[model samples]
Target: MSAIDDLADQLARDALDAAARLGDDRLIDDISKAIGASSPVSQEAFVSAVRIRQALARGRAVMDSRLTQAASQKAGPEKSGG
Candidate 1:
């Protein structure tokens, strides 16, 4: 992975660890309340991120299929003594 990906992965792991260590009912309640009170901009950003992820997944699937098809075509001629 790239350096940025490694850093982001580390940060996410650390954040999850910190959250797990809270182990407080009140803190969990407060976090739930805060999450339910997200602003419109944050909501929009979350939706946009979801959409982008979906688009990327679809693009990757298409690229993978195309690559597989190209490889099969290239191998077909070779196998046929072309």
Candidate 2:
């Protein structure tokens, strides 16, 4: 795979892992709060929270990918990098 594709795939896997670790219930709660309010201000806040969460997920994925790659490199040539 190209380096960019590899990186993306690795990132996706990491995000999935983090999501699993954090548990779905918490995520659901956060999403619910972000989208559940009535007032315009509250709705705006919710939207912002949703955006923040999305960004965080992306960050987590990137971090996970980097860590996986680092670990594989440390393990030597027999192992593949993420």
Candidate 3:
């Protein structure tokens, strides 16, 4: 596969993994309701909103991982800065 296609595939897999982790029926219902409510808006706006939400979610996940790693390092004994 081309580089872009491979990246897309990886992203799809990651999204599936994240969705599986959520595994909350109520959360899914809420998301569905939000999307349904957006249907009255122009198609462009709906697509933009979805993309923005996804980007924000990805950013949150990255920030969460960095915070967790920093906390773990701080909790452990100091290591040589080698």
lDDT of 2 by residue, 1-82 (tens): 5554454445444444565788764654454455455444444444444456678979999999999999989888675588
* 10 residues in a row with least lDDT, candidate 2: 38-47
lDDT of 3 at 3: 55
Q: Order the candidates by lDDT, highest first — what do you get?
A: 2, 3, 1
Off by over 4 Å in 2: 1-37, 78-82
TM-score of 2: 0.48
TM-score per model over all chains: 0.48, 0.48, 0.46
Candidate 1, residue 59: the lDDT equals: 100
Clashes of each: 0, 0, 0
- Candidate 1's displacement at residue 55, Å, is 0.6
lDDT of 3 by residue, 1-82 (tens): 5554454445444444465688743543354356457553333343444455568879999999999999999999987899
Write down the lDDT of every candidate, Cα atoms only. 0.53, 0.58, 0.57
Q: How accurate is candidate 1 locally (lDDT)?
A: 0.53
Stretches off by above 4 angstroms in model 1 are: 1-36, 77-82
